[model samples]
Target: MSQILLIMASVRPSRVADQLADWIHARNTLGLSIETVDLRDWPLPMDDEPHQPKQEGFDGYRSEHTRNWSRKVDSAAGFIFLLPQYNWGYPAALKNALDHLYSEWQGKPVVITSYGAGGGGKAADQIAQVCQGLHLEPVPTRPALPLKAAERTDAGRLVDPAAAFAAQAADMQAALGELAAALHSA
Candidate 1:
């Protein structure tokens, strides 16, 4: 199976990031392997290695968490980052995680699924730059999920299972499908 890491980029309490990730995952029908990776489970600290990741490599990763996470990135053929915009940017945790690797991410295809005020387009653009710097292929066809039209709220609780989110989910799944095809050709 061509592996694709579905990264849940938000780790906030009472958020819709995971549910959004799940929506993309459930709609995947391309037969590619999809593994959901929640950054919350991997508490990676700041990038403080003696040398850069390109020079240090996975063997230089003294921390077990870093090494294990490296392996996951190394194994993936593509990625889908479920981005929850914060102050018009991606979460710090996601940035730290992406910064912790080098060769493991080289040449891999990545699709951004951004959700927030105005669909997190600013964050998507910023992340695309970051991915390019890492030598990763950032796909251009990103799907945006704006909170007002896409999110369902009931009694002050955030819910995303309503029919309103279906359109956005479908668009993201299409982007994911394109990523899978790009990965095969990459």
Candidate 2:
């Protein structure tokens, strides 16, 4: 099975990143095995590894949390990051979590689903560049699902969910599955 790790980059109690991820993952992924990693579950502080880990083998981090995170990344065939734009960028939690690992991310194809009032394009763009530096393959077809800033959610129901946005969610999820499947073969 092609295992894909779905990461939700939000720790805030009311943030919508995980909700968005669930919304996306609920669709058909053509039988792909899906797992989840939410920052809220693995709250990481600033990168505090005692030493940088080995690049190829992925060994050396002193922090158990970081080691666990690396193991999670190493286990997945690919990834989907639900990065919610905060103040025109991704949350520091996501950055810190990413900084904890190095070689584990290399060559992995990541599907970045960025959402925000301003389309979360900037955050996605920034992370793509970061991923490049880490030698990870951010998927060529980046899915930027921009949500309205003032969009409301009451007990999980989006107050004004648009048909276009819903369609985008479905389309992006489908494309992401296809890309992940192809990457898994490579």
Best by TM-score: 1
- TM-scores for all predictions: 0.90, 0.86
* Candidate 1 lDDT for residue 15: 81
Model 2 poorest ten-residue lDDT run: 155-164
Q: How far is candidate 1 from the true structure (C-alpha RMSD, Å)?
A: 2.0
Among these predictions, the greatest lDDT belongs to 1
Error of 2 at 16 (Å): 1.1
Per residue, candidate 2 scores C-alpha lDDT tens digits across 1-186 of: 777888898788777665576666665456667788888899666857766655766567787787788888888878888898887788888888778888787878888778887678889988888888887777666676767643565764455444426657665766676666667678
- Model 2 residue 109 lDDT? 81
Model 1: lDDT equals 0.82
Give the poorly placed runs of model 2, Cα more than 4 Å off: 56-58, 149-151, 154-157, 160-164
Task: Give the per-residue Cα lDDT of candidate 1 at 141.
Answer: 86
